[model samples]
Target chain A: MSHTLHREGRRRDLRGEFIVMSMAAKGINDAGAGPKLRRFLRIARKHGAVSVSDVKSVMHAVFTDIGAVESVLRDLRRARLGLSVTVTGLVAPIHRACCRSEVAEEPHTVAHSLGVWGNRRRLPSETVLSVMTMCGHSLVSVPLVEQAVASVRAGVCSPRAAAVKLAEPCVCGIFNVDRAARLIARLARSGKRR
Target chain B: MVQISKSKCVCCHRCALFCPVAAIRSGRDGASWIDEAICVECGVCVRNGCLSGAIRRRRSPWPRSVRALFSDPVTKHRSTGVPGRGTAESKTNDVTNRIQPGQVGLNVELGRPGVGTSFHQVQQVTRRMAKAGAGFEEQNPLTHLMSDRRRGVFPRELWPERVLSVVVEASLPLEELAGVLKELRAVERKIGTVFSVSVYCRWADRRRMLALVDRRRLLPQAKVNVGLGRARRQR
Candidate 1:
C-alpha cells in the first residue's frame, strides 16, 4: 500500500517537533504503531532539506515517497511560493523527547552556566542571531558584517576594513564573507534590512 | 535494519507505536519486527524511543555502510578517516587548509529523507568538477566514494548505494564561481531529488560573487556564514 501524505502549511517549528492535533487525537499510526516526536524532527531536517530558518512556508507529508514529495514540491512552486523539497524523512507521532541538547549552540560547552551563556553581550541580537543561526554551521555571525555593509555603503568603513570585519567571524573559513559583503552593501543601500 | 530484541522487548509496542514509515509491525508473538525494505535506518527508535535498550542495529555490510556513514555520527568515514561528514568541511577549513587564499570551495549536497542516493547525483557532480581540474577535498564523504578523484568517479560497486545526503566538495579559483554555478544548474533538472550548494570563499571575494549572483540570479537562497569564532586579523 502507498503511504499517506499529510500537508502542514508553514508553521514555525523551531525544534521541528510539534504534532498535528487532529491526527494525534485520532492516534496517528502507521500500521499498528505510531511515530515518535524526536524521530519526526530528525527525519524532517535530515530528509526535508528545507531551510529550518525563516521557512515562511512548508508542505509536510508523511508516508510519502520521492514521487509524492516531488509532486508536492512542484505544487508549492506552482503556488508561487519559494520552496523546494530538497530532502524528505520520516517522523513518528508519539512525544517524549527533549532534544534541545542535540542541536544547541556550541556556547554551552564553554560556559559553565546558562546565565553566563545568555549574558554573552558580545553575541548578536535575536534579529541578527535568527538570521545568522540559519547557517547551522555557526561560522557566519559577524557584527562587523552588518557594520561593514553600512559603513561601506556610507563610505565610513574602508573596503579593506570591511573585509577584515566580515572575515573575523569565519574561523572555519566556510562563511563566504565576500559574497555577503556585496549582498550586505545592496541590502543596506536598499534599506532592505536583511 | 533496526532490531527489537525479543528477550528485551516488553511488547509495549512503544518503540514501534510511532514509526513514521510503518516499518515496524507486531509479530505473531507480539514482538516487534522492522521490515528491512521500509526501514531507512534513521536511528530515531534506538536513540529516543527504546526504553529497554532492546533496539539495536545489525552490522551493515558493504553498501549499507552508506547508511551508517550518514546515520552514526561517530562512525569515521573509511575513505577520509574523518568522523562525521566532511571533516567538518565547514567547521575546520581554517585548520585543514582545504580552502586557500583567493580561492573558494563549493560543497554540493544531494539527498533524500528516508530513501537515499544511488550515487547517480553525486557522480554527475564529480564528473563535472573533475573535468574542470578541480580537486575534491580529501576529507569529504563524497571524495571517499571516488575511485578516481580526478575523474570524479565513485567505485562501481557503490553506484546503487544509498545514504541520507552526500557532500561533494571541490575548491576552485574564485573566477570559476560562475562556471561552477552553471555546472550545477545544468545537472539540477537531471536528478530525482533536490539539493543545495554552498560556496566557500574569502571576505574579499564577496563583491564578485554578488555580481555573478545578481547577473545569473543564482543562490538567492544560500546563507552567508561569517566565521565569528575565528581569530581576527584586527583583534
Candidate 2:
C-alpha cells in the first residue's frame, strides 16, 4: 500500500518529490528483519530523508533531492540485504538514479496512475490537490493545506515552518517537507498574483 | 470512532479544520463533536492530536470497526494481514509476479482523502468488473468481504460501512483491457466519489498499456519496481 504513487504535479515540480520503500516480504524474509530495516532507516536519515517510517514490512522514506535518493539507493545495493526496494517519482530521473546506482535491474515493472477518473468536481483546487495527494492516504486534509497556503501568503509563517506543520498529519512519514515548502510557496505566490 | 471530550475541549475547534471529510462540526459557541455517520474512522483528527487533549477514540463494533481496518494505515486488516487498504502485491508487482505478462491487473480505487466511500459504492464498481469477466484477486481484503464473488456482491449488512478509500482489485487477459475500460467509464458516472485507475503489467507491456489509456488523464508520476527483489516465480 504505497501512497507514493499517483502523486500529481508538473514534471519540474515532481522532480523535488521522491519516495523509497524497502520491504522484507512476510514469508520470504520478514523473520529477523528488524536490524536490517533499522539500518535502512539510518542510511535514509543520514542522507537527509525528510521523513521515515520504521514499520517492518512497509518501511519507507521520502527525500527532496535526487542526489540523496541516489546515494541511499547505492548504499542499499551495496548492503545486498536482499530486500525489495521500490522508488516512486518522475520516470526519467528515477531511471537515471537507479542506473547510476547500478540497481536498475532488467525486467522491472512500472505502475502508472490514470489520475482521478470520476467526480472531478468534488476535488479541491489544482494546487491544493497537488499538496494533499502527497500524503497518499489523504491524512493531510484540504483545510490544513489551505490554511498553510494562507499562512504563507499572509506572512504569518514561513514556507518551511508551514511545510513542517503540513507534514505532521501524515502518519506514514512519506511526506516530503522540502517539496511541500516549495509547493506551499508557489500556492502563496499564485494567490497573491490573483 | 472518535469524539471530542466536552470536559477537556476548550472550544478551540482546531480538529474541525483538519478533518478530511469535514466530519467534525463546531457549534456557534465553538463547541465541537464528530459526526459519527460521516466519520470514516481514519483517526486523522486524533492522529493530528487535540491541543486540549479533548479527542478520544471509542471502541467501534464489528462492521463499524471495518472502517479503521481499511482507512487506518497502522491497523492491519485481519482478512489479509496487510497493513493498508490494498494488498502488498499491488505495490510489489515485479517481486511477486502477481500480474504476469499475459494479464493486466486493474486497480479501481474508489474515494479520495476528503471524499470517503461506502461499501455499497465499492460494490457498484466490483459488480461492473465482475460482469466484464474480471476475476478478483483472492488475497485482496476487498475480495475477502465479497458475499458473492461471482456477482461481486457484498452482504446487505456491510453496505453501510465506510472507509477513507479502497482499491477493488481484479485481473483479466491482456486482450480485455478495452472492454474493462469501457465498463469502468459506465460505472464512473454512477459512483458518487472520485477514484483513480492504476494498471499493472510486465515491464515489456508498459508501452502497450500506456497506448490504450487516454494520455490527458495520466499523472506525471509513475511507480517503477526496479526488480531489486528476487522474483518468487521464474520467468
Candidate 3:
C-alpha cells in the first residue's frame, strides 16, 4: 500500500485522510490473522473509521478524523496483538498523534513522495489529482473525476452521489468517500466559478 | 486481460470516457473496442459494469498475463503474494526495519496520474538508478521482471507490455540521494509516460535526507509508520 502514501492535496485538504493497514508475516503469524483482524476492524469502526477493507492476510481501515487515529492507535497498543499496524498520512500530525497515544517513540520511518514528475504538463488540475490519487492504483481516472465534477456542476447528482460514483473503481478499498465528497463539491464549485 | 465484447457493445461510447489511457474507441462499425496495445488492463471498464454487459475480463496466456498482474489490484502477483504494483515498502517499517538509518529507499513509480507505462519505460529508469549505484530491492514485484539486476534489463519479450503503474524499488546511501535524483531528472524527459519519485527513510534520518531534496518538489503530505506496532527492531 506504499502507493497510498502519495495522495495529493494541501494540508487542510488532506486533514480528513488517514489510512491504517495491518498485516502479519505470511506463514509465521498469519495462522490466526482472521480473528485478530476482525477485532481490529471492530475497534476501527468503533473509533469512526469511514471504510474498512477486510481480507485474509492484509486489512485496512480508513479514518477521516485524527482523533479516531489516535484513539485507535492507543487501543491497538493496549491490545498488543503483535500485528504490524501502519498509518499513511501527514508526518507531523501522525507523529503528534503517536506522541499523544504515548507510543514512546517517534515515527519509526516515513515515505515522502517528491510529488508527480515526468510528463506532468498535461495532467489534470491539482483538485483532480487530489481526488484521483486517493486510489493509489490510478483506477480513478482523470475523465471520471471530470465527469463527477461536470455532473455536480450541472446539478444532475449530489456531490456525495458523484463522489460515490468516482470511488467505484478503486478495488484497494482505501478511497475515502467522505473526503472525496468534500473535494468533489469543491471541484464543482470551482468549475462553476470558472 | 479485459476486452469490450463486440456483440454486446451498444457503441454508446460512454465507456471510452472511463478509460484512463484512452484505450477504448469507436471503430468503423460504430461499436466500442479496446486497443489491446494501449489497454493497461486496469479493468476500469469492466469494473464500472456496462449495463449492456459489453466489457468482460478473460485471463491471458503467460507473459501477456503480466499486464493484469501489474495493473489490476484484484490480481495478485504470485511471486510476491501481494496485490498492486509493488510491495509494502516503508509502510510497515516500524516493525520490519526494511529501511535502516543512513539508507534511503527510493520508489520510482512509472505510469501514474492516469498515464499508463510499458516495461520499456520502466527499464529506462532502472538502468539509470542502477548506474547511480543504487541496489534494487529483491522482494519488489518490479525486480522480478528484471532479466539482469545489474544492468536493470527486463526480458526482451516483456518490454512491450504496459500497465497502470510499475514501482522501481531501490536503495542507496543517504548522501548519494541528491545525485540520484539529479540522474533521474536528467533522464525524465526520455521516458514517454509520467512517473513520481518517493523517498523512504528512517524517521531519525529524515531531517538530513530532506536537506538533500528540494522541499518545493515534495508533496506537502507524507506516509509515516508511527511506531504503533508491538514489535520493535533491535539494533
Candidate 4:
C-alpha cells in the first residue's frame, strides 16, 4: 500500500535525488541514431526529465535517477530503447575518485601561477580564494569571505555559522561547509593577528 | 555571471534566500548585486531561481567569458564552439580522437554544485599533470587558462579569477595513473576546496580502475553517457 502511494508521490518528484546520471549509446553510419535517441528521450520524459542537454552528437539528461525507475531501465532492451548500442559511456560526479599512489613530482607553487596579468587582478590569498571558489557558479566573493572571517574572529558568528551563512546563497547545496569552516577558522586566526 | 534586470526587479529576496552560496547581496537602493568573484554562474537565481524575472545571464568577455560556459548549461563554449562545459564528445573518448587506446582519461573536476572551484585550484591539478607530462585535452576550456602549457601553470594574472566549476581533462599512460592519483590526494589535503574526479579508460581496464577505486576506499558510483544523437546507418 505504501509502495503504491510512494510511486504516486514519485511521479511528482524523483524523491529528492538531485544527482543526474545520463547514459548514451554512441556512433552511427550515415542514417542517424534518431530512433535510439527518441527511446532515451521517451524514458527521460517518463521519469520527468529535469534538464535535457544537447551536445551535437549526443543528448545527455541531467535528471534524477532512483530505485523504482532503476528497475524499469534495468529491464530496458537495446532494441526496445532503439539503437544498435555500438558504444556506451558514462558521466558522473568528479568527486568520487580518490585513489592513493606515490608521487615522484613536487606540487606546483603559487608564485609560478601568476603569469602575465597586465592590469588584471590577482586572486586573493590562497586560503580566501579557496573558500570563495567553492560554488561552481562563482557566486561567492572574497569580501564576503573576509567579512565572514572578521565576524568569526569578533565572536559575532561562529566559524560553523559563518560557513553555513556563506553557503546560504548557493541553492545547489554543493558548498563544502566542512572545508569552509576550516578556512574560516584559518582566515579568522590570520585576521586576529592583523 | 548572473544578470539582474533592475527595471524588472521587485527587490524580492527569494533568489537571495535560495542562493546556496549567498552570493547575492542587496545594495542600499534595494537592488541586488552579485559579487562576480564568488558567483559561480549557476542559473539558480535566474532560471526560475527568481520569481521576479529580474535575474538573467550576463555575458562575459575573454577569460571571463568562461563564466557562462561552465556555469550556464545553455551557453556554448567559445573556444571549442561546443554547447557544454567540458570537452566535446572527446571527454567521453568517443570519436574525438582525443584519448587513444591503452590510455586513461583523468578528469579532475574542480568544484561541486555549491562549492565551486577557482582556476587557482584547477591550476594545481593541471600543473601537476603537466609536470608529469600528461597531455591536456586541447579542446577543453580549462586548458585555455594555461598561461604556460609547458610548465602546467595558469597565468598568474588569471589566478585571482574564479569560476563556479571547471574540468581539467588530461590523458596519460595507463600505468602512470597511480602517481597522478597520489598527487591529487595530496592536493586534497592542502587546498581548502572540495572536488571530485572522473577516470575514463578502455572497457578492458574497468577492473583495474575498480581495483584502484577500492584501494582508495571510494564508492563505485559513475554516471553513464549514452550518446543517442549519433546517427547510425545500415550497411
Candidate 5:
C-alpha cells in the first residue's frame, strides 16, 4: 500500500510538470510569439533524454523565453512518467497513446513553426532550428540583429557578424555570403539598409 | 652591414611572430637572434619587424655569375651607346639583349644569348615535382615523425634542428641579431612541427648559420645574410 501511494504521488508530480511544460509550449506556438516555442521543444527533444541538468544547460544556452523553460521542466516530468509507466509493465494502452499522440504532436509543432519561418526566409528550416537551438532566440529578432550589426560596424565583431545577425552561429556555418551581401547591398541601394 | 643599436631593441615579439620560418629565438637577455641555416633569407623579418632600426642588410660583392651575366659585351655595348650616335640595330639589339641583375628577362631565341636557367621554369619544375611526390614520397611527414622521436632521445637538437639560415653584417647589434633569429624560428614553428633550432652568427653578423630539423636528419646548412653588395659595407 505504501509503494502504491508513493507511485501515485510521483505520477501526480509528473502530470503537474507536464501540464506546465505543455502550456508553455502552447503559448510559444501562439500566433506572433516567434519561434521560441519550437526552438525550446526541439532542444528538449534532442537533450531531454539526458539528465535534467543537461537539458537545462541546453535550454539556458538556446532559449531566453521563460515559457520555454517551463515547457522543458514539464517535458522532464512527462519523460519521467513515461519511464515509470514503462517500468510498471502497463504497456498496451500507454504504448498506443504514446505512438498516436505524443510522438506525432511534438514533431508536428516543430514542423509547423519551421514552415512558417521558411515562408519568409530562404534559409533552410533546419538551419533556423539550429540557430535557435544555439542562440536561445528567434533568427529574426530585431534586437539581436541590431546588436550584431553594431558590433561589426564598430570593428569589434568577427567576420561572421551579418550571418550571425541572421541567426547563423558562425561565418562558415552560413555559406551564403553572396546572397547576404546582395541583400545588404540591395537594402543600401534602396535606402532600406541598416 | 646592417646594425641594431642597443637602445632600440623593444622585445615586443612582433618579429618573432611573423617570421615565415621559425628560425628566430629569444635569448635570456630578452633580445632576438637569427639561426642562419634555418632562415630562408626571405627578408620577411627585416620588412615586418625591426621597428628599432636594429636589423639592416650587409653589403658584399656581387656573385661572379650575376656580374658576368650583366657585364657581357652585348650588355656594355647597349648601355654605352655606339660612338655617340649608335645605329638603331645596335640600339634595338642592345635593348632586346639586355639582362638586368634582378629582373628575369624573357628569352628571345634570336636576341642576345641567355644566361643561367630561368628561375620561373625552375620553380615550376620544383612545384611539379612536389605535386607528383606529394602523396607518397613527401619529406614533411617523415621529418615530423622523426623529429618527435628524436626529441625524446636528444634535447640539444631541439633548438638547432629545423632552421633556414640568413646572413647579416658582423656589426649588427646582438639584440637586433636576436630579433631576426627569433622571428625566423617563430615562422618555422608556424609552418611545420619545428623540433630544434640553432643559430650561428658568422663574422659577428655578416652571416647567420642555422641548424634546423623537423624529425628526420639534421639540416645544418641554411644561411641568411644581406646580398652580395650589401654584406660588404656596414650601414
Candidate 6:
C-alpha cells in the first residue's frame, strides 16, 4: 500500500481506539472520538513534534481508557514499525509504561535507556515519577525529582537490566548500553536522571 | 483582514479562545468574527488557532499602481521601515556595535528621553528590557511580551507601536536574570544581532548591578538623571 493509504488505515485504527477509550473512561455516549482524534493528529502533524504531555492531555480528555499498556504498545509500534505516529507521542507511551511497572527492575532500565536514546530531551516529571513509583518508590512527589541512588538502592534493579528491557520493543534502533549507563550516571549526579 | 465563514466553522472556539486580545466573538451561526478595531493584527488566531480555513486574510492597503516603484529603495524603506535591500547592514548600523566590558547595565534611554527618572527607575527599566530581550531570544515572545513591564523590553517594533520612554526601574531576581542571559544567547543564534543593554541604579547600588552585568558589553551606558525638577536644581 502507498504510505498515504497505510497512514489512513492506522489513523482509522487509532480513531477506533480513541473512541473505545473515551467511552470507557468518561461513560459518555458522545461519538466525537473520530473528530477529536483527527483534530489532535492534524495539530500534531502541523507542529512536527508532539510532547508526552500532549498525548497525556488527549488521553486524559479521552477518559484514560487508553491505559499505559495500550499507549506504550501504540508508541512502540509506531516508533519501531514506522507507523507515522507523532514522534514525541510515540516515546510518551513507553515512558508511561516505565512509570507504571511494578517490577522493581524495569523502570530504572527504561529510564536509563530513554535518557540515552532521547538524549537531552527531558521526559515529563510525571512519567519519570510514575516509573519510579512503579519500581516501588514512594509517590511523595507528584512531579518532583527523586534521588536516583536512593531509588535504585531501594528497588535493587541494575541500570543494565533497565536498558535491556527498554531496548526490547525498539525495533528500529539499537540502544547502546554503555552510552546509556554513562548518561544515567551523569544525570544521577546532576539530579536529572528522573 | 480575514473573514470567518460561519457555515464552515466547527465552533471549536479555538480561534476566539486563543485570541491574545479577546477580539473574536461567536456569532449565532456558530462562526467566530473578529472585531476589526480591537484586533491587534497579531495573526496568532489566523496562524495557530484556526483549524478550519474559515478565516480569510486580506492584504493590507497598497501604496501605488506602478511596478517600477517596487525596486525603489526609498519607497521600499518607507513601506517596510527597515531599509530596503540593506536590512542586515542597516540593523548593524542602527546600534553601537562595540561590546564594551562592564556595559551590561548601562542605562540608555530608548524612545523619547526626558526627566523625573531616577537611578532606581533606570535600573528597573534596563533590567526589564534585558529580561524581555532574553525572552525574545528564547523564542518565547508571548511570555516576554506578557512579563512584568519592569522585566520586559517594550517591543517598539510591534504593530500599533506606542511611544513610551523606557528607564531601568530596579534590580531583578537572580534566577530571572540568569534566564534572561540564557535567552539572549539563544536569540543571538537566531537573529544574529547582539543586544546592548543599559543599566541604571542608585550610585551606592551601582556595584551590585555592575556585578550582574559582569563586565559584558551586554549592558552599557549606565548613568543617573534627575527628575524634571531635580534637573533644574542641579543646573
CAPRI rating of model 4: incorrect
lDDT at residue A165 of model 4 (Cα atoms): 73
In angstroms, the error of model 5 at A7 is 67
Model 2 per-residue lDDT at B79: 52
Per-residue error for B153 in candidate 4, Å, reads 2.6
- For residues A34-152, write the lDDT of model 6, one tens digit per residue: 45444444433333321111221222111122353344333433332211121111223333433443211111100000011001122234234223211110111212123333444
Cα misplacement distance, residue B116 of candidate 3 (Å): 0.7
> Candidate 1 at residue B23, lDDT?
63
Chain B TM-score for candidate 1: 0.75
- What do the candidate models score in CA lDDT, each in turn? 0.43, 0.80, 0.81, 0.51, 0.26, 0.30
TM-score of each: 0.48, 0.93, 0.94, 0.59, 0.20, 0.25
- Two-way TM-score contest, 4 vs 6, winner: 4
lDDT of 1 by residue, A1-194 (tens): 00011111122322232211001101112122123323333444554432122110112223223333333333333332111122212221110111221111211000000010111233443333332332223223233345555677788876555655544332222222333344455555675442
Give the TM-score, chain B only, in order for the candidates.
0.75, 0.92, 0.93, 0.81, 0.28, 0.36
Q: Model 4: how large is the Cα RMSD against the reference?
A: 12.5
lDDT tens digits, residues A19-60, model 4?
A: 322224333332445565666656555666544433344443
lDDT of 6 at A82: 15
lDDT of 5 by residue, B154-176 (tens): 12323332212110111122233
Task: Report the number of the highest-DockQ candidate.
Answer: 2
lDDT of candidate 1 at residue B59, scale 0 to 100: 64
Which portions of model 4 show Cα errors greater than 4 Å?
A: A1-31, A43-194, B1-8, B77-83, B88-101, B213-217, B224-235
Top model number, lDDT: 3
Question: What is the C-alpha lDDT profile of model 2 across B1-235, one tens digit per residue?
Answer: 7888888989877898788888888877678988899898888788775887889887688788788888877775475444455677545665577888877788877886457899999888888888889999887788888899999999898899888898888888878887888888998887788887888777788888888877887888877777777543222
Please tell me which model should have the higher DockQ, number 1 or number 6.
Answer: 1
lDDT of 6 by residue, B82-132 (tens): 222111110111121111222222222221111111222223334544555
